[model samples]
Target: MSAAEVSVRRRRGSFGRLFASEVHLVFGRRRNQVGLLVLFGLVTMLGVALKVSAMRHPGDRGGDLFSLVAGNGVFLGFAGLTIEIALFLPLAVSVLAGDAVAGEANLGTLRYLLVAPVGRGRLLVVKACALGVGALTGAVLVALAGVLVGVLLFGAGPLITLSGSQIGLGDGLLRLLLAALYVAVGLAALGMIGLFISTLTEQPIAATVATAMVSTLLWILDAVPQLDWLHPWLLVDRWSAFIDLLRDPVFTDRMVTGLWVDIAYGAVFLFAAWLRFRVKDITS
Candidate 1:
Protein backbone atom coordinates (compact mmCIF):
# COMPACT_ATOMS: atom_id res chain seq x y z
CA MET A 1 0.00 0.00 0.00
CA SER A 2 1.07 3.61 -0.61
CA ALA A 3 2.10 5.88 2.27
CA ALA A 4 -1.29 7.66 2.22
CA GLU A 5 -3.12 4.34 2.34
CA VAL A 6 -0.83 3.13 5.12
CA SER A 7 -1.51 6.30 7.15
CA VAL A 8 -5.29 5.88 6.76
CA ARG A 9 -5.12 2.26 7.88
CA ARG A 10 -3.03 3.20 10.92
CA ARG A 11 -5.52 5.89 11.88
CA ARG A 12 -8.39 3.41 11.62
CA GLY A 13 -6.49 0.94 13.75
CA SER A 14 -5.74 3.56 16.38
CA PHE A 15 -9.35 4.69 16.51
CA GLY A 16 -10.53 1.12 17.00
CA ARG A 17 -8.03 0.49 19.78
CA LEU A 18 -8.92 3.74 21.50
CA PHE A 19 -12.62 2.97 21.32
CA ALA A 20 -12.07 -0.51 22.74
CA SER A 21 -9.99 0.94 25.57
CA GLU A 22 -12.67 3.46 26.42
CA VAL A 23 -15.39 0.80 26.45
CA HIS A 24 -13.30 -1.36 28.69
CA LEU A 25 -12.62 1.56 31.06
CA VAL A 26 -16.31 2.35 31.26
CA PHE A 27 -17.40 -1.23 32.04
CA GLY A 28 -14.32 -2.15 34.03
CA ARG A 29 -15.06 0.22 36.88
CA ARG A 30 -16.52 -1.35 40.02
CA ARG A 31 -19.26 1.24 40.35
CA ASN A 32 -20.46 0.73 36.78
CA GLN A 33 -20.53 -3.03 37.34
CA VAL A 34 -22.57 -2.53 40.52
CA GLY A 35 -24.93 -0.25 38.62
CA LEU A 36 -25.49 -2.93 35.96
CA LEU A 37 -26.02 -5.55 38.66
CA VAL A 38 -28.55 -3.31 40.32
CA LEU A 39 -30.41 -2.97 37.03
CA PHE A 40 -30.53 -6.76 36.60
CA GLY A 41 -31.49 -7.31 40.21
CA LEU A 42 -34.37 -4.87 39.95
CA VAL A 43 -35.75 -6.63 36.87
CA THR A 44 -35.44 -10.02 38.55
CA MET A 45 -37.24 -8.72 41.60
CA LEU A 46 -40.05 -7.36 39.47
CA GLY A 47 -40.47 -10.77 37.83
CA VAL A 48 -40.50 -12.60 41.17
CA ALA A 49 -42.95 -10.15 42.65
CA LEU A 50 -45.30 -10.56 39.73
CA LYS A 51 -45.05 -14.33 39.99
CA VAL A 52 -45.99 -14.17 43.69
CA SER A 53 -48.86 -11.83 42.98
CA ALA A 54 -50.16 -14.18 40.32
CA MET A 55 -50.11 -17.10 42.78
CA ARG A 56 -51.97 -15.15 45.47
CA HIS A 57 -54.55 -13.63 43.15
CA PRO A 58 -55.06 -15.65 39.99
CA GLY A 59 -57.22 -12.95 38.46
CA ASP A 60 -54.92 -10.06 39.20
CA ARG A 61 -52.62 -9.19 36.30
CA GLY A 62 -50.77 -6.45 38.18
CA GLY A 63 -51.57 -3.33 36.12
CA ASP A 64 -51.00 -1.83 32.67
CA LEU A 65 -48.69 -3.93 30.48
CA PHE A 66 -47.60 -5.63 33.66
CA SER A 67 -51.04 -7.27 33.82
CA LEU A 68 -50.13 -9.22 30.69
CA VAL A 69 -47.08 -10.71 32.39
CA ALA A 70 -49.38 -13.22 34.07
CA GLY A 71 -50.34 -14.68 30.69
CA ASN A 72 -46.97 -14.49 28.91
CA GLY A 73 -43.44 -14.21 30.24
CA VAL A 74 -42.36 -11.87 27.42
CA PHE A 75 -44.38 -9.00 28.85
CA LEU A 76 -42.08 -9.03 31.84
CA GLY A 77 -39.35 -7.54 29.66
CA PHE A 78 -41.69 -4.79 28.55
CA ALA A 79 -42.83 -4.15 32.10
CA GLY A 80 -39.26 -4.02 33.34
CA LEU A 81 -38.27 -1.65 30.54
CA THR A 82 -41.23 0.60 31.31
CA ILE A 83 -40.19 0.91 34.94
CA GLU A 84 -36.51 1.33 34.03
CA ILE A 85 -37.04 4.05 31.41
CA ALA A 86 -38.92 6.08 34.03
CA LEU A 87 -35.70 6.72 35.96
CA PHE A 88 -33.10 3.99 36.36
CA LEU A 89 -32.03 3.93 32.71
CA PRO A 90 -31.53 7.68 32.59
CA LEU A 91 -29.53 7.55 35.80
CA ALA A 92 -27.38 4.77 34.42
CA VAL A 93 -26.68 6.73 31.25
CA SER A 94 -25.95 9.81 33.30
CA VAL A 95 -23.38 7.97 35.38
CA LEU A 96 -21.47 6.87 32.32
CA ALA A 97 -21.87 9.93 30.10
CA GLY A 98 -21.46 12.37 32.95
CA ASP A 99 -18.17 10.74 33.83
CA ALA A 100 -16.93 10.35 30.29
CA VAL A 101 -14.63 13.34 30.51
CA ALA A 102 -15.04 14.51 34.10
CA GLY A 103 -13.93 11.15 35.47
CA GLU A 104 -10.65 11.29 33.56
CA ALA A 105 -10.08 14.88 34.60
CA ASN A 106 -10.83 14.04 38.20
CA LEU A 107 -8.23 11.30 38.12
CA GLY A 108 -5.69 13.68 36.52
CA THR A 109 -5.38 11.39 33.50
CA LEU A 110 -7.17 13.44 30.88
CA ARG A 111 -4.15 15.55 30.10
CA TYR A 112 -2.06 12.44 29.66
CA LEU A 113 -4.62 11.00 27.24
CA LEU A 114 -4.73 14.28 25.35
CA VAL A 115 -0.97 14.25 25.08
CA ALA A 116 -1.28 11.30 22.73
CA PRO A 117 -1.64 11.67 18.96
CA VAL A 118 -5.46 11.55 19.04
CA GLY A 119 -7.22 14.86 18.53
CA ARG A 120 -9.67 16.18 21.13
CA GLY A 121 -12.57 15.75 18.72
CA ARG A 122 -11.67 12.13 18.07
CA LEU A 123 -11.38 11.48 21.78
CA LEU A 124 -14.81 12.98 22.34
CA VAL A 125 -16.19 10.81 19.56
CA VAL A 126 -14.75 7.74 21.17
CA LYS A 127 -16.19 8.77 24.53
CA ALA A 128 -19.63 9.30 22.97
CA CYS A 129 -19.47 5.90 21.26
CA ALA A 130 -18.49 4.24 24.51
CA LEU A 131 -21.33 5.95 26.36
CA GLY A 132 -23.80 4.84 23.70
CA VAL A 133 -22.56 1.27 24.01
CA GLY A 134 -22.83 1.38 27.77
CA ALA A 135 -26.39 2.73 27.58
CA LEU A 136 -27.38 0.00 25.10
CA THR A 137 -25.74 -2.63 27.26
CA GLY A 138 -27.74 -1.58 30.32
CA ALA A 139 -31.04 -1.58 28.40
CA VAL A 140 -30.39 -5.00 26.90
CA LEU A 141 -29.35 -6.37 30.28
CA VAL A 142 -32.67 -5.36 31.86
CA ALA A 143 -34.67 -6.82 29.00
CA LEU A 144 -32.67 -10.04 29.02
CA ALA A 145 -32.84 -10.39 32.78
CA GLY A 146 -36.57 -9.78 32.76
CA VAL A 147 -37.06 -12.36 30.02
CA LEU A 148 -34.93 -14.97 31.79
CA VAL A 149 -36.61 -14.52 35.14
CA GLY A 150 -40.07 -14.33 33.65
CA VAL A 151 -39.52 -17.49 31.60
CA LEU A 152 -38.09 -19.36 34.54
CA LEU A 153 -40.94 -18.37 36.81
CA PHE A 154 -43.96 -18.07 34.53
CA GLY A 155 -42.99 -19.63 31.15
CA ALA A 156 -42.77 -18.10 27.68
CA GLY A 157 -45.15 -18.50 24.77
CA PRO A 158 -47.29 -16.44 22.44
CA LEU A 159 -47.66 -12.84 23.58
CA ILE A 160 -51.04 -11.18 23.90
CA THR A 161 -51.06 -7.74 22.35
CA LEU A 162 -52.89 -4.70 23.64
CA SER A 163 -55.03 -4.95 20.51
CA GLY A 164 -56.30 -8.29 21.80
CA SER A 165 -54.29 -10.29 19.27
CA GLN A 166 -51.48 -12.81 19.59
CA ILE A 167 -47.96 -13.10 18.16
CA GLY A 168 -45.72 -16.14 18.09
CA LEU A 169 -42.82 -16.57 20.53
CA GLY A 170 -40.14 -15.65 17.97
CA ASP A 171 -42.03 -12.52 16.91
CA GLY A 172 -42.62 -11.54 20.51
CA LEU A 173 -38.92 -11.85 21.32
CA LEU A 174 -38.04 -9.82 18.25
CA ARG A 175 -40.40 -7.06 19.35
CA LEU A 176 -38.86 -7.19 22.81
CA LEU A 177 -35.41 -6.65 21.31
CA LEU A 178 -36.70 -3.75 19.26
CA ALA A 179 -38.24 -2.21 22.34
CA ALA A 180 -34.93 -2.50 24.17
CA LEU A 181 -33.13 -0.80 21.28
CA TYR A 182 -35.73 1.96 21.17
CA VAL A 183 -35.29 2.64 24.84
CA ALA A 184 -31.53 2.64 24.37
CA VAL A 185 -31.82 5.32 21.71
CA GLY A 186 -33.62 7.58 24.14
CA LEU A 187 -31.00 6.85 26.78
CA ALA A 188 -28.26 7.65 24.28
CA ALA A 189 -29.79 11.07 23.78
CA LEU A 190 -29.72 11.56 27.50
CA GLY A 191 -26.08 10.51 27.42
CA MET A 192 -25.31 13.25 24.93
CA ILE A 193 -26.77 15.81 27.31
CA GLY A 194 -24.65 14.31 30.06
CA LEU A 195 -21.58 14.52 27.85
CA PHE A 196 -22.13 18.23 27.39
CA ILE A 197 -22.54 18.67 31.11
CA SER A 198 -19.36 16.71 31.76
CA THR A 199 -17.42 19.21 29.65
CA LEU A 200 -18.50 21.99 32.02
CA THR A 201 -17.31 20.40 35.25
CA GLU A 202 -14.40 18.40 36.58
CA GLN A 203 -16.53 16.81 39.29
CA PRO A 204 -18.01 13.63 37.87
CA ILE A 205 -20.56 13.30 40.66
CA ALA A 206 -21.87 16.79 40.09
CA ALA A 207 -22.16 16.19 36.37
CA THR A 208 -23.92 12.86 36.99
CA VAL A 209 -26.43 14.46 39.37
CA ALA A 210 -27.04 17.37 37.03
CA THR A 211 -27.59 15.15 34.03
CA ALA A 212 -30.00 12.92 36.01
CA MET A 213 -31.87 15.92 37.35
CA VAL A 214 -32.40 17.16 33.79
CA SER A 215 -34.22 13.93 32.95
CA THR A 216 -36.17 14.06 36.18
CA LEU A 217 -37.26 17.60 35.41
CA LEU A 218 -38.38 16.67 31.94
CA TRP A 219 -40.39 13.77 33.33
CA ILE A 220 -42.01 16.02 35.88
CA LEU A 221 -42.99 18.53 33.23
CA ASP A 222 -44.29 15.75 31.03
CA ALA A 223 -46.63 14.59 33.81
CA VAL A 224 -48.41 17.93 34.03
CA PRO A 225 -51.76 18.03 32.25
CA GLN A 226 -51.58 21.79 31.70
CA LEU A 227 -48.25 21.40 29.96
CA ASP A 228 -49.72 19.22 27.23
CA TRP A 229 -48.68 21.82 24.70
CA LEU A 230 -45.04 21.51 25.80
CA HIS A 231 -45.08 17.75 26.26
CA PRO A 232 -44.08 17.08 22.69
CA TRP A 233 -40.88 19.03 23.18
CA LEU A 234 -39.73 17.29 26.34
CA LEU A 235 -36.96 14.72 25.94
CA VAL A 236 -38.57 12.22 28.30
CA ASP A 237 -42.05 12.77 26.90
CA ARG A 238 -41.90 9.98 24.31
CA TRP A 239 -39.66 7.56 26.14
CA SER A 240 -42.57 5.25 26.82
CA ALA A 241 -43.23 5.07 23.08
CA PHE A 242 -41.45 1.72 23.18
CA ILE A 243 -44.74 0.25 24.38
CA ASP A 244 -46.13 0.70 20.88
CA LEU A 245 -43.76 -2.03 19.80
CA LEU A 246 -45.86 -4.49 21.80
CA ARG A 247 -48.98 -3.73 19.77
CA ASP A 248 -50.11 -6.30 17.28
CA PRO A 249 -49.97 -4.07 14.23
CA VAL A 250 -46.96 -2.36 15.80
CA PHE A 251 -47.62 1.36 15.93
CA THR A 252 -44.70 3.34 14.52
CA ASP A 253 -46.05 6.90 14.66
CA ARG A 254 -45.01 7.58 18.20
CA MET A 255 -41.82 5.60 17.82
CA VAL A 256 -40.92 7.54 14.70
CA THR A 257 -41.62 10.85 16.39
CA GLY A 258 -39.55 9.67 19.33
CA LEU A 259 -36.68 8.71 17.07
CA TRP A 260 -36.72 12.13 15.47
CA VAL A 261 -36.80 13.83 18.84
CA ASP A 262 -33.95 11.66 20.11
CA ILE A 263 -31.91 12.40 17.02
CA ALA A 264 -32.51 16.11 17.37
CA TYR A 265 -31.50 16.16 21.00
CA GLY A 266 -28.51 13.92 20.43
CA ALA A 267 -27.19 15.93 17.51
CA VAL A 268 -27.63 19.28 19.24
CA PHE A 269 -26.03 18.23 22.49
CA LEU A 270 -23.27 16.29 20.83
CA PHE A 271 -22.36 19.39 18.83
CA ALA A 272 -22.52 21.51 21.95
CA ALA A 273 -20.23 19.05 23.73
CA TRP A 274 -17.78 19.21 20.86
CA LEU A 275 -17.85 23.00 20.84
CA ARG A 276 -17.36 23.26 24.60
CA PHE A 277 -14.64 20.65 24.77
CA ARG A 278 -12.85 22.24 21.84
CA VAL A 279 -12.21 25.35 23.88
CA LYS A 280 -12.20 23.80 27.36
CA ASP A 281 -9.02 24.48 29.32
CA ILE A 282 -7.70 21.30 30.85
CA THR A 283 -6.22 22.28 34.18
CA SER A 284 -5.62 18.85 35.62
Candidate 2:
Protein backbone atom coordinates (compact mmCIF):
# COMPACT_ATOMS: atom_id res chain seq x y z
CA MET A 1 0.00 0.00 0.00
CA SER A 2 1.14 3.56 -0.69
CA ALA A 3 2.50 5.52 2.33
CA ALA A 4 -0.19 8.16 1.85
CA GLU A 5 -2.95 5.55 2.00
CA VAL A 6 -1.34 3.91 5.04
CA SER A 7 -1.22 7.29 6.84
CA VAL A 8 -4.83 7.97 6.05
CA ARG A 9 -5.84 4.53 7.29
CA ARG A 10 -3.87 5.00 10.52
CA ARG A 11 -5.56 8.38 11.19
CA ARG A 12 -8.95 6.92 10.50
CA GLY A 13 -8.16 4.03 12.85
CA SER A 14 -7.17 6.48 15.58
CA PHE A 15 -10.41 8.45 15.19
CA GLY A 16 -12.41 5.25 15.34
CA ARG A 17 -10.60 4.17 18.48
CA LEU A 18 -11.37 7.45 20.24
CA PHE A 19 -14.99 7.29 19.20
CA ALA A 20 -15.27 3.78 20.55
CA SER A 21 -13.69 4.83 23.83
CA GLU A 22 -16.22 7.61 24.24
CA VAL A 23 -19.04 5.19 23.55
CA HIS A 24 -17.73 2.69 26.02
CA LEU A 25 -17.40 5.47 28.51
CA VAL A 26 -21.03 6.40 27.91
CA PHE A 27 -23.27 3.37 27.28
CA GLY A 28 -21.31 0.17 27.02
CA ARG A 29 -22.49 -0.94 30.43
CA ARG A 30 -25.63 -2.11 32.25
CA ARG A 31 -26.11 0.93 34.47
CA ASN A 32 -26.23 3.30 31.51
CA GLN A 33 -28.54 0.94 29.67
CA VAL A 34 -30.91 0.87 32.61
CA GLY A 35 -30.74 4.64 32.79
CA LEU A 36 -31.74 4.98 29.18
CA LEU A 37 -34.64 2.67 29.71
CA VAL A 38 -35.81 4.45 32.81
CA LEU A 39 -35.57 7.84 31.13
CA PHE A 40 -37.61 6.64 28.20
CA GLY A 41 -40.21 5.18 30.50
CA LEU A 42 -40.48 8.47 32.32
CA VAL A 43 -40.98 10.31 29.07
CA THR A 44 -43.70 7.93 28.02
CA MET A 45 -45.45 8.11 31.34
CA LEU A 46 -45.41 11.90 31.42
CA GLY A 47 -46.53 12.13 27.84
CA VAL A 48 -49.44 9.85 28.45
CA ALA A 49 -50.45 11.70 31.58
CA LEU A 50 -50.39 15.07 29.83
CA LYS A 51 -52.35 13.65 26.94
CA VAL A 52 -54.92 12.25 29.31
CA SER A 53 -55.22 15.58 31.09
CA ALA A 54 -55.81 17.41 27.86
CA MET A 55 -58.41 14.85 26.89
CA ARG A 56 -60.12 15.28 30.24
CA HIS A 57 -60.09 19.06 30.06
CA PRO A 58 -60.67 19.25 26.29
CA GLY A 59 -61.85 22.81 26.09
CA ASP A 60 -60.22 24.44 29.09
CA ARG A 61 -58.95 27.86 28.13
CA GLY A 62 -56.50 30.49 29.42
CA GLY A 63 -53.79 28.30 30.94
CA ASP A 64 -50.14 27.78 30.15
CA LEU A 65 -49.65 24.93 27.71
CA PHE A 66 -45.93 25.06 28.35
CA SER A 67 -46.61 24.44 32.03
CA LEU A 68 -47.54 20.87 31.20
CA VAL A 69 -43.88 19.98 31.51
CA ALA A 70 -41.04 21.01 33.77
CA GLY A 71 -38.89 19.55 31.08
CA ASN A 72 -39.24 16.43 33.19
CA GLY A 73 -42.69 16.47 34.88
CA VAL A 74 -44.69 16.92 38.11
CA PHE A 75 -48.26 16.50 39.29
CA LEU A 76 -49.17 19.79 40.84
CA GLY A 77 -52.28 21.92 41.13
CA PHE A 78 -51.06 25.36 40.10
CA ALA A 79 -47.57 24.71 38.75
CA GLY A 80 -47.00 21.06 39.43
CA LEU A 81 -44.91 20.80 36.32
CA THR A 82 -42.28 22.97 37.96
CA ILE A 83 -42.35 20.87 41.10
CA GLU A 84 -42.12 17.66 39.15
CA ILE A 85 -39.12 18.84 37.13
CA ALA A 86 -37.49 20.28 40.22
CA LEU A 87 -37.53 16.89 41.88
CA PHE A 88 -36.99 14.47 39.02
CA LEU A 89 -34.66 16.29 36.62
CA PRO A 90 -32.07 16.77 39.34
CA LEU A 91 -32.34 13.11 40.20
CA ALA A 92 -31.68 12.25 36.58
CA VAL A 93 -28.74 14.62 36.43
CA SER A 94 -27.36 13.22 39.65
CA VAL A 95 -27.58 9.63 38.50
CA LEU A 96 -25.87 10.10 35.14
CA ALA A 97 -23.41 12.78 36.14
CA GLY A 98 -22.40 11.61 39.61
CA ASP A 99 -20.71 8.55 38.18
CA ALA A 100 -18.90 10.45 35.44
CA VAL A 101 -15.40 10.79 36.89
CA ALA A 102 -15.91 8.84 40.07
CA GLY A 103 -16.88 5.69 38.18
CA GLU A 104 -13.55 5.78 36.33
CA ALA A 105 -11.69 6.44 39.54
CA ASN A 106 -13.43 3.55 41.29
CA LEU A 107 -12.68 1.15 38.45
CA GLY A 108 -9.02 2.19 38.43
CA THR A 109 -9.36 3.37 34.84
CA LEU A 110 -8.69 7.03 35.44
CA ARG A 111 -5.09 6.34 36.39
CA TYR A 112 -4.84 4.11 33.38
CA LEU A 113 -6.10 6.89 31.13
CA LEU A 114 -3.90 9.56 32.68
CA VAL A 115 -0.82 7.39 32.27
CA ALA A 116 -1.55 6.91 28.57
CA PRO A 117 -0.39 10.48 27.66
CA VAL A 118 -3.83 11.93 27.03
CA GLY A 119 -4.14 15.51 28.27
CA ARG A 120 -6.33 15.92 31.37
CA GLY A 121 -7.99 19.04 29.99
CA ARG A 122 -8.89 17.27 26.78
CA LEU A 123 -10.33 14.36 28.69
CA LEU A 124 -12.41 16.70 30.77
CA VAL A 125 -13.59 18.49 27.67
CA VAL A 126 -14.60 15.24 26.03
CA LYS A 127 -16.44 14.05 29.13
CA ALA A 128 -18.16 17.41 29.42
CA CYS A 129 -19.32 17.14 25.86
CA ALA A 130 -20.77 13.74 26.49
CA LEU A 131 -22.57 14.85 29.63
CA GLY A 132 -23.73 18.06 27.96
CA VAL A 133 -25.19 16.09 25.10
CA GLY A 134 -26.91 13.73 27.50
CA ALA A 135 -28.44 16.57 29.49
CA LEU A 136 -29.58 18.50 26.43
CA THR A 137 -31.01 15.38 24.88
CA GLY A 138 -32.94 14.50 28.00
CA ALA A 139 -34.31 18.03 28.31
CA VAL A 140 -35.42 18.09 24.71
CA LEU A 141 -36.97 14.67 25.01
CA VAL A 142 -39.11 15.67 27.96
CA ALA A 143 -40.16 18.91 26.31
CA LEU A 144 -41.00 17.21 23.07
CA ALA A 145 -42.84 14.49 24.87
CA GLY A 146 -45.00 17.02 26.64
CA VAL A 147 -45.63 18.98 23.47
CA LEU A 148 -46.53 15.88 21.55
CA VAL A 149 -49.00 14.62 24.12
CA GLY A 150 -50.44 18.10 24.51
CA VAL A 151 -50.97 18.63 20.80
CA LEU A 152 -52.38 15.19 20.26
CA LEU A 153 -54.89 15.33 23.09
CA PHE A 154 -56.07 18.90 22.72
CA GLY A 155 -56.11 19.25 18.96
CA ALA A 156 -54.86 22.48 17.30
CA GLY A 157 -55.76 25.56 19.29
CA PRO A 158 -54.32 28.80 20.59
CA LEU A 159 -51.53 28.28 23.14
CA ILE A 160 -52.40 29.89 26.41
CA THR A 161 -49.52 31.62 28.15
CA LEU A 162 -48.66 31.60 31.86
CA SER A 163 -49.91 35.17 31.98
CA GLY A 164 -53.30 33.97 30.70
CA SER A 165 -52.74 35.49 27.28
CA GLN A 166 -53.28 33.59 24.05
CA ILE A 167 -50.74 33.16 21.30
CA GLY A 168 -50.60 31.49 17.94
CA LEU A 169 -49.98 27.81 18.72
CA GLY A 170 -46.85 27.81 16.57
CA ASP A 171 -45.35 30.78 18.40
CA GLY A 172 -46.07 29.16 21.75
CA LEU A 173 -44.10 26.16 20.62
CA LEU A 174 -41.17 28.38 19.69
CA ARG A 175 -41.21 29.69 23.25
CA LEU A 176 -41.14 26.11 24.51
CA LEU A 177 -38.03 25.48 22.45
CA LEU A 178 -36.46 28.53 24.02
CA ALA A 179 -37.36 27.21 27.47
CA ALA A 180 -35.80 23.87 26.60
CA LEU A 181 -32.60 25.66 25.66
CA TYR A 182 -32.29 27.42 29.01
CA VAL A 183 -33.39 24.40 30.99
CA ALA A 184 -30.89 22.27 29.13
CA VAL A 185 -28.18 24.80 29.90
CA GLY A 186 -29.15 24.72 33.58
CA LEU A 187 -29.17 20.93 33.72
CA ALA A 188 -25.71 20.85 32.16
CA ALA A 189 -24.49 22.75 35.18
CA LEU A 190 -25.87 19.95 37.32
CA GLY A 191 -23.89 17.52 35.22
CA MET A 192 -20.72 19.53 35.84
CA ILE A 193 -21.42 19.58 39.53
CA GLY A 194 -21.58 15.81 39.42
CA LEU A 195 -18.34 15.71 37.43
CA PHE A 196 -16.66 18.00 39.93
CA ILE A 197 -17.69 15.76 42.78
CA SER A 198 -16.57 12.72 40.83
CA THR A 199 -13.07 14.20 40.73
CA LEU A 200 -13.09 14.52 44.51
CA THR A 201 -14.04 10.92 45.33
CA GLU A 202 -14.24 7.44 43.91
CA GLN A 203 -17.69 6.75 45.33
CA PRO A 204 -20.21 7.38 42.58
CA ILE A 205 -23.15 7.27 44.97
CA ALA A 206 -21.67 9.86 47.27
CA ALA A 207 -20.82 12.17 44.44
CA THR A 208 -24.27 11.79 42.94
CA VAL A 209 -26.03 12.30 46.23
CA ALA A 210 -23.92 15.35 46.96
CA THR A 211 -24.81 16.85 43.60
CA ALA A 212 -28.51 16.35 44.27
CA MET A 213 -28.26 17.57 47.84
CA VAL A 214 -26.45 20.74 46.91
CA SER A 215 -29.07 21.49 44.32
CA THR A 216 -31.92 20.76 46.70
CA LEU A 217 -30.41 22.80 49.49
CA LEU A 218 -29.94 25.79 47.31
CA TRP A 219 -33.49 25.49 46.17
CA ILE A 220 -34.70 25.34 49.73
CA LEU A 221 -32.69 28.40 50.60
CA ASP A 222 -34.00 30.24 47.62
CA ALA A 223 -37.54 29.51 48.71
CA VAL A 224 -37.06 31.52 51.87
CA PRO A 225 -37.96 35.12 51.16
CA GLN A 226 -35.63 36.14 53.96
CA LEU A 227 -32.64 35.02 51.90
CA ASP A 228 -33.25 37.69 49.30
CA TRP A 229 -29.61 38.61 49.13
CA LEU A 230 -28.48 35.20 47.91
CA HIS A 231 -31.50 34.43 45.73
CA PRO A 232 -30.21 36.02 42.54
CA TRP A 233 -26.96 34.10 42.87
CA LEU A 234 -28.76 30.79 43.33
CA LEU A 235 -29.05 28.71 40.21
CA VAL A 236 -31.77 26.89 42.12
CA ASP A 237 -33.73 30.09 42.50
CA ARG A 238 -34.04 30.68 38.78
CA TRP A 239 -34.31 27.08 37.66
CA SER A 240 -37.90 27.44 36.57
CA ALA A 241 -37.72 31.08 35.64
CA PHE A 242 -37.33 29.64 32.19
CA ILE A 243 -41.12 29.38 32.38
CA ASP A 244 -40.93 33.04 31.45
CA LEU A 245 -40.01 31.81 28.02
CA LEU A 246 -43.69 31.14 27.35
CA ARG A 247 -45.15 34.29 28.82
CA ASP A 248 -47.03 36.78 26.69
CA PRO A 249 -45.38 40.15 26.10
CA VAL A 250 -42.39 37.78 26.36
CA PHE A 251 -39.68 38.20 28.97
CA THR A 252 -36.63 37.41 26.92
CA ASP A 253 -34.37 39.67 28.99
CA ARG A 254 -34.75 37.66 32.18
CA MET A 255 -34.45 34.41 30.32
CA VAL A 256 -31.18 35.64 28.75
CA THR A 257 -29.84 36.51 32.19
CA GLY A 258 -30.78 33.06 33.46
CA LEU A 259 -29.08 31.43 30.49
CA TRP A 260 -25.86 33.37 31.06
CA VAL A 261 -25.87 32.48 34.73
CA ASP A 262 -26.24 28.79 33.95
CA ILE A 263 -23.57 28.94 31.24
CA ALA A 264 -21.15 30.65 33.61
CA TYR A 265 -21.67 28.00 36.29
CA GLY A 266 -21.21 25.20 33.78
CA ALA A 267 -17.90 26.73 32.65
CA VAL A 268 -16.67 27.12 36.22
CA PHE A 269 -17.48 23.54 37.23
CA LEU A 270 -15.91 22.12 34.08
CA PHE A 271 -12.78 24.18 34.71
CA ALA A 272 -12.59 22.96 38.28
CA ALA A 273 -13.02 19.38 37.12
CA TRP A 274 -10.13 19.79 34.65
CA LEU A 275 -7.78 21.31 37.20
CA ARG A 276 -8.58 18.80 39.90
CA PHE A 277 -8.39 15.89 37.52
CA ARG A 278 -4.83 16.77 36.61
CA VAL A 279 -3.71 16.55 40.24
CA LYS A 280 -6.01 13.71 41.23
CA ASP A 281 -4.42 10.45 42.27
CA ILE A 282 -6.68 7.95 40.61
CA THR A 283 -5.05 4.91 42.09
CA SER A 284 -7.10 3.75 45.04
Top candidate on TM-score is: 1
**lDDT tens string, model 1, 15-39?**
9999999999999999999999999
The global Cα lDDT (0 to 1) of model 2 is: 0.68
Residue-level lDDT of model 2, residues 1-284, one tens digit each, is: 99999988876675556546765767666876676556555656655676566556665533344334322132111132354457666777787776678877777777776776456776776677778777776666666655554445434455556676777766766766766667778888888878888789898889889988988887889889999999888876677876776577887777677777888888888889888988887676
Clashing pairs in 2: 74-84, 76-80
TM-score of candidate 2 relative to the true fold: 0.80
lDDT (C-alpha) at residue 177 in model 2: 72
Off by over 4 Å in 1: none
Clashes of each: 1, 2
